[model samples]
Target: MRVVMFGYQTWGHRTLQALLDSEHEVVLVVTHPRSDHAYEKIWSDSVADLAEKHGVPVLLRNRPGGVELLGALRDAEPDIIVANNWRTWLPSEIFDLPPHGTLNIHDSLLPTYAGFSPLIWALINGEPEVGVTAHRMDAELDMGDVLLQRSVAVGPHDTATDLFHRTVDLIGPLVTESLDLIASGRAVWTPQDRSRSSFFHKRALEDSRIDWTWPAEDLERFVRAQSDPYPNAFTHHRGERIRILSAAVSEGRYGGTPGRIFIREGEGIVIVTGAGARSGRLPGLVIKRVRTEDGTEHAATDYFRTMGGYLTPRP
Candidate 1:
């Protein structure tokens, strides 16, 4: 099959590599230009770079519009269009151009987590499992019919980055199987249940702010969701910004204001959390590690030298 791929970043790079390794022919590749933003994560194995290495023509466009793009697709005459982590809206002119139609590889199970940072959102929401879904492309975002779905268990200690690596590994197999089904004319299409669907907007630095009012478990998940490669969940302390690297739910029950910093024996600096929805006992979270605005990383004990203050949203 002649595939015209639309993708960007690591997800795109991996998918393109899988397709190239397969019997399918990737005639044309469309990817976004390298972003200069310091916070944004540029792909280590970029789709554009991979395409060039394979001697496939590449187009760097955020939006797949204009006559040049349309003409390129027409000239290539793609049998099917495969998109993975493509950031822009693709008009029907391109998606509907191919004979086998377009297929998209999404990071989450369809009918849920349908937008940006799906793995992060799922982890923050405390989902038991995270999965990837291969589905038919439609005008609506991620509201397509399902072709293939695979899930990975989200362990209690699994961070968003951990889940991300696991999820990406599934993409290649999912894409290959989906394409095989499509080529064999045995592809099954399952319509998504709109009632069960949920969409999330793109995340920003502001979204990573740690809200102390949340339950201890939720806050712990928040920290894990944004750790390392992504922005760490943060809070303000005495006009200083502290990025929470990792945390865990403490076993003790403390009756105090939420977000108040307290030391626990062998547990590090523990912050009181909100009362459980049903348990009524106040929960707490043990801070494992943090990074201060001054760019110093510290263990909780060293960071909160004398901790008796509350962590507030404002300095």
Candidate 2:
């Protein structure tokens, strides 16, 4: 079948690969145009690059729903339109032109995690399960008829960056299967239950701050959620901001006030937390690694020893 593709970021890159690997004929690609020098870094791989490699026509548009975009798709006359990680709203004119309408691949289960940063928000809220869903595109953001979904377990050690890589890995095969089913006319479209829908906000640099008022386990989850590549849970010590690289929730007691340094053992430093965030348990975290404002990473205990000032502060 002749296909028109629209996608952006890593997810879109995977979708294009899936379509190229499958039996469908991708006639053209619609992607965001290059921006000013300052904004360019935020944009990932260009769809035009992939199109050129595959000998497919590429359309660079800041918005995908405009009249010019509609005219382009109409002229190409693709049988199916597949959207993935695209930033713009897909207008009805383009959707109606394709005999199969349009199918979109969302990075979460329908009616849940329905916005950008779905996985990051899931990690922040301490959710154990996250997944990818392919759905029939509609006007609403991620509100559409579901075509397929696959769940991934979020381990205690899992972070937003980890889940993102795993999700990207699944897109190649998952999208191919969903497209095949739709092409064969066996696509099962299930409407999402809007009653159960929830959305999340984007993760800002400030969102990485660790709130000591939250319990130990809650702090632990927060630490793991943003760890490594994305960002790290952070706290203030001796008036300096320190990023918590890794931490383990302890079962024992730490009676000190939240943010107080309870003990220093080997490479670890036990930091106190509140009772509520712990889900009714002990209140603190054992941080293995931390960062100083000087940009140097240190074993939590070492930083405590080297710095003369108070390592722990009262909340």
Candidate 3:
């Protein structure tokens, strides 16, 4: 099959590599320009560079659907369009151009998480598993008919980075398998259940700010979700920003106001947490490690020498 690939970053890079390795020919590649956003910088393997190295035609665009881009796609005459981590919403003319239409590879099990930073969100919400979905693109964003879907179990202590590594491995095999099915006319596209669907917005630095009102378990998962290479979950202590590097739920339940620097338990410093903290039944968040603004990491016990202060949402 003659393929046109729309992708960006490592996800796109992986998808393009899969296409290149497969029997199909990648005629044209469309990818986003480099981004300065913190999250975008991580896992950023260059899709454009890989395409150029292989002598495939490449177009750099912040968004798709320009007249020149449209002309390029038409000239390339792709039998199918395969997209992964394409940042912008593709118009129908672009996605529906080829005979087989567009196949999008997303990082989550669709009809649930159908938007940006899915792994992080899923980990934070304590989903049982996280995976990738290969589906046919239609009018709605990520609300496409499924071609192939694969998932990995989210372990109790798994971080977002762990989930990323596991699920990314699925991209190559999933892309190739889905394409083979489509080319041979054995593809079974399943319609997404809109009733079970959910969409999320792009993550920003502010989204990592710690909200102590959440229960300790939720906060612990939140920290793991925003693990290193992404962004650390953070809080403000004594007018200084501190990122939570490692944390756990305290074994004992002792609470006052949320975010209060309470007592030490084992190797961590317990911070009173949850809206119902005053009842002293909810477990506090035991902060094990923290990073200062200057990039210095420290044990939470050493950082909080004297307790009884509050960790605020802002300094």
Candidate closest to the true structure, highest TM-score: 3
Candidate with more favorable, higher lDDT: 1 or 3: 3
Supply candidate 1's per-residue lDDT for 21: 90
C-alpha local distance difference test of each model = 0.88, 0.77, 0.95
Model 2 — which ten-residue stretch has the worst lDDT?
Answer: 306-315
User: Per-residue CA lDDT of candidate 2, range 10-109, in tens?
Assistant: 6887899889989999998998766542223342666779888999989888786567778888899999899887776677777667999888888887
Name the lDDT value of residue 88 in candidate 2: 66
**How big is the positional error of residue 117 in model 1, measured in Å on the Cα after superposition?**
0.3
Over 4 Å off, model 2: 33-45, 275-281, 306-315
Against the true structure, candidate 3 reaches a TM-score of 0.99
Preferred candidate (lDDT higher): 1 or 2? 1
Name the better of 1 and 3 by TM-score: 3
RMSD of 3: 0.6
Minimum summed lDDT over a 10-residue window in model 3 is located at: 57-66
Q: Pick the candidate with the highest lDDT.
A: 3
- Predicted candidate 3 versus true structure: per-residue lDDT over 1-315, tens digit per residue: 999999999999999999999999999999999999998999999999999999998999998857999999999999999999998899999999999999999999998999899999999999999999999998899999998899999999999999999999999999999999999999998999989999999999889999999999999999999988888999999899999999999999985999999999999999999999999999999999999999999999899999898999999
